[model samples]
Target: MITNEQITAYNEAAISVLNGSAKNAKSRVKVFRVSQLIAQETIMESVDGLHLPESSRETSAMILMNVCCNKVVRPIDGSCCQPPSAPALTQKLAAGFFGLSIAGCLILHLVHRHGHRRSRPCADVEAGEEKKAAPAASACPSEVVLQSCCKLGLIMAYFYLCDRADLFMKENKFYTHSSFFTPIIYILVLGVFYNENTKETKVLNREQTEEWKGWMQLVILIYHISGASTFLPVYMHIRVLVAAYLFQTGYGHFSYFWIKGDFGIHRVCQVLFRLNFLVVVLCIVMDRPYQFYYFVPLVTVWFLVIYITLALWPQITQKKANGSCFWHLGLLMKLASLLVCICFLAYSQGAFEKIFSLWPLSKCFEMNGNVYEWWFRWRLDRYVVFHGMLFAFIYLALQKRQVLSEGKGEPLLPNKMSNVLLFVSVVSFLTYSVWASSCKTKAECNELHPAVSVVQILAFILIRNIPGYARSVYSSFFAWFGKISLELFICQYHIWLAADTRGILVLIPGNPMLNITVSTFIFVCVAHEISRITNDLAQILIPKESAALWKRLACMAGFFSALLLLSSIRGEHRR
Candidate 1:
């Protein structure tokens, strides 16, 4: 055993070296001071040992160096630093804006109430004659304006809370790989609590589609939360799920255009507004790039493609007086042409980048950013939506010929043909599973995904179409989640995952399970509210009976002008 006097001597020597080094270390003075204090504590605790082990001594030295280095390397950039106090003038302007928003909301609410009261006397007189009260008009212009202001203020407040107010702010940590069984457990729990859809429905009906989207979105959420992208199987499955969403997009848009044949500006605006409203709002409030929430842009682009292709072709737009075969041929030709265009873009990465990086969109990127990154991400499953459109055309054609009929309650194929379809589906499922399992890299998987994904998508469609499969096995619970799935996907980037989607924020530190539960609950609730707001806005922006053509055109122009001005102002502020 070492004597106390020797230990004391060793401590004295350590303290002298620490002080001399600290005196010499000018750049890392703070770190040295901290390290010296820690060293003194360690020495006191280890008094029985006259001399530290070689490894322990080395470790202590490393700890000291690291402490000093961390202090010296701490970030000084404005991006990570605590924001400086706002100028008095700027603070006054912010207060004014908040005051105006609140005042506007209250005034609008009062005006509405007054108007309702004024209209009541007339309704009462009519009530005596047994006439029903006229349906209340949609939310008035002032009310809409007030609602818009309130939403803007709420978003700004939320961003403040997340970033500067310290309410939601916390240390951001890189995502760690979670347990393999996490996703499995998530799915099982979701299934256990699933609310089955009991209403009669056709194969791939609205409810069924909703259920598909809901379940896929839920699974994707789980995948993201678990940080399971490092696991190849989970990664591949998530890819397939993303492909399924695009497939639904292709099917939904094509079916709507085919049946309604109304590709008006109003329809286009409504769809785009629904898809992009939340994302655009967040972009302004959070001061992020447009491409930050990319899914909306992807869907918007595809919708344009479908709309333009159908609206431009006379043969495709003609009524069904022409033979069904002719319609099918026209559709096939269009799809083939689309495929050719996609292939050409894929052949030349430069051309693809050039197209997406043009003019207004170029402004979305900060200095020195490469367009190729965006191009690569978009192209990975580029052809999946086209596959969906092709399938939709085939399905519709079969339905027109009465080969597939929900009303008849009959199988689309004879017993022998059904067996063949079933066999094909099983084979396709196995093939995709094997292919996904065997892939070793993202590039390899992306190269093979376009073709492999179709097999599984078709398998799911076929399986769902079996007599009672769609109606009897639907999940109402998943369908509800599906309705707000887009919001969840976009919002999670900032609110659920932090640091530009690279990490998670430590909220209720040291309790991962409770943190996740609380975060997810809050995330889901916010997403639902966002969806409701978007729907309400859509109703206001795209009413059923639109104004005259000239009026509508004028309104569109005015709206775009205002949006451009607002964007320019935001850009200047960011600078």
Candidate 2:
């Protein structure tokens, strides 16, 4: 039996496998044969632990390796080298940019302070009406206080810009297509900007990464401030913005994990559930500002399909042998089952809508006859749904190891239940497709197809259950886009607000193409820039006096409170 000391030695050596400083560790450990290594429990456990926590796993492994190497090797050779620190220029520039961004934030904060002072109640309506008067006066900060704060002053300027644009828009009265056209153009331009910056400007030391995280937190602050101070509508209130802010942060957190490559079923579930949180919140809080009803189907269909397909996918990872017909057939059947679920969903939804017609809830979500046409109204809208599905597939692939492992050692039955499920799914999809194809007119299709919605929901459940079927094509690309999706989603309105104020696209009245093209382009670039700046800021700012995760989140809440003032002001002004 291996002594405890020997086992400890073996565990350290195993960790050294990934550690950077273990250059000579291999030579030292080579004294022991492969048989000795295979017999080590610590080594096996270390390797097993590698698949946990998507972020920091690589670093953790490195640390483990380094520790092990120290124990086994006198002077580790061929170990990973520590990266040199950033050059002075990089550091200086980072600091300079960071300071400038903070200054911007400070200015905005000060302006907000001033806005509050001005809004303070005067001695009017004292004594008897004191209670009512206090509530009214305390309702919001005053305009005078706002003007005093320089940072808020810029926000106010933006608000005025929006106001001016709104006047122009109201006069021109853009139709649906025209509305999104400008924004699309701006988004493209932003993409180009990001592409130009893709070259590695500098490598971030661990310290720098931490600093950058702080910077990111601060940038979030700016948005939160603007949300509270700026003139957005009541519907676009601070509470809603905060929820979206959580989503943005969550996405960033998830991305950190994705890049690190440590994935499992639990992590996948977290991402799915977190993303769903935003979807649910938005559904409850926001009305489709425009005919942007497309986001509903766009976001819905992909998750629905992927969830269902994956939920029932026979465990391909479990099979120790090479791939076989059973795997392929099982996957196909799983997909089919999803389709069947979708069919049932569609039928059920239709039934509900028919029964609930004129019901208060149904009225709010009355669908058009040709739901597909509604979905296809903007080609881009369809892309959102397409991308959503793609993302689900991508997540599945990333967590393939865990999913496949789960299916291992199961009895090999014909999987008759899966087959039946698949049949139902296929029929549902076909039925819905037929209905879509046979629709007489777009107007007739305007009545939202309840059956179609059901189909989507069922599909989602099926995809979620499937295993090893999802192959994501564009991880990096989509990740980048997804990172800023919140910005694109929110800034669309701001860009529109700005352009309408400026009368820039007034000539192309009712042309959504122009609106989408220009506004999207500008919105994307601006949002991307803002994102970069904020990320940088998050690195600099810390929850000083050191705290826990929940406390950190609370700090964020405080930061958001400051930002909410900006949003409330903006919303109030807009209204």
Candidate 3:
């Protein structure tokens, strides 16, 4: 309606204002490229802080936390395999337990010392010359509980510090599987120099078994730390080491029952307590499921299976009153029955899965509501225990017939017999190694694993025991490590390794050598302490007297009932 010049001037001014606004918006946004990807982000500073509404002085912590705790939602690749992280609840519980355990240990120690000093003065006056029996440390429930808690606290602190705070962790510290042989060489060099046992080592005796367990555990630790499972030959051999452990379980338990002729439930309970007390505590502390520590579950199940097999009707024992050929035949029949059942179970993965998926067992074993992992683990080592029983049967039969003997100054027949046995073992060893290396996949390796893993186990035993001096003397260094191998196995999943054993733990951060050295020292020391606590707890839990056993069992049942109730509540909350 107005003049053309005036209208044009109005429109130009409006256009200039719009352009300035667009420029300001562009300035607020940042565009960047990383490698092949590009993204845009808006940058801004905090205008106001978070605060809890209507909080008093006592509740002021809520406000502080609200303001201080900033969360960054880092996008992780959902498809790639990674370790589970600590949850908020896990961190809180772990922190509390850490504090209580450490402080409780110190306070209890002071109280115990003070009480002992007070008792000494009275004892000097009351008993002029007679010495009173010292109180049994194992009998004290308070000390055992405190020590166990202390063990848990220390380990949790190390785990929390290393994993969450990244105290000793370094980025991009990937393990090189190609360097596997280097550790073997160094370990062998060290092994040769360790002082030998003075006692004449019997076949599979404590010293011998300990040394065997030590070297095997060492290999397993190396295998896990280096992520060498991808290397076929090494992976397959490590599988054999695992099989050997199960073999020990069968042989040791069977030998104990047959030779000692003690099939009492207390013996079984003691063994279970020793094996699982630390693991159960860890399950609670680490907030991991029982199935998370795969090895213990595997070993535990096998132990139970072996126990049931021997404890069934017609108990066979060479040391028992009914120790005759018929009883020995009964042992063979039981072993055969076990093997047949194992074969049937192994024949169908679905059937195995269905069996383990049953209500109560599923709660213990299933990961993400599936037993695929358990099935894979269970089936791979299914027949190994039977092999152990068979081996024990044959060995015991031979010993009973006086064809073989154990102890000092006794040669296992002529030196030629030993040499021939050693030569055959070497052949079997190389043959298995070659075949294992040729496998393209783990499935293929596991297919023949049940049958051929025994080859490696037997070969190692023959090679170890065939030599005259080697049979007589053992390495004390390896034996020492062997003593705590179980603890090491369970503890390594947390502090020694990281991310539930998918990564190695770093304690020094910079130099890999120094880091490994320091971490290994701390790891060994912690494991040793854990081993002591486990022993002390086991001693108290499995009492010698019948009345005390029932009392302990009642207490344990109540404890478990409470745990189950809490777990149920947690599940309901999640739902």
Best by TM-score: 3
Sorted by lDDT, highest first, which candidate order results?
A: 3, 1, 2
User: Candidate 1: deviation at residue 143, Å?
Assistant: 1.4
On the 0 to 100 scale, the lDDT of residue 51 in model 1 is: 41
User: What's the lDDT for all of these models?
Assistant: 0.69, 0.38, 0.74
How many residue pairs collide in each prediction?
A: 0, 144, 0
Candidate 3 lands at a TM-score of 0.79
- Segments of candidate 1 deviating more than 4 angstroms: 1-99, 107-141, 163-180, 198-200, 315-322, 364-368, 405-412, 544-575
For each candidate in turn, the TM-score is: 0.77, 0.31, 0.79
- By lDDT, is 1 or 3 better? 3
lDDT of 1 by residue, 398-466 (tens): 766778546435565776787789888988888778878888997788887777776788898887776
- lDDT of candidate model 2 versus the reference: 0.38
- Candidate No. with top lDDT: 3
Model 3 over residues 293-349: C-alpha lDDT tens digits? Answer: 888898889889988888888777777624477777778889989988899988888
lDDT comparison, 1 vs 2, better candidate: 1
Give the alpha carbon lDDT tens digit for every residue of 146-190 in model 2. 322333233323433443222333222223432333434544454
At residue 174, what lDDT does model 2 achieve?
26
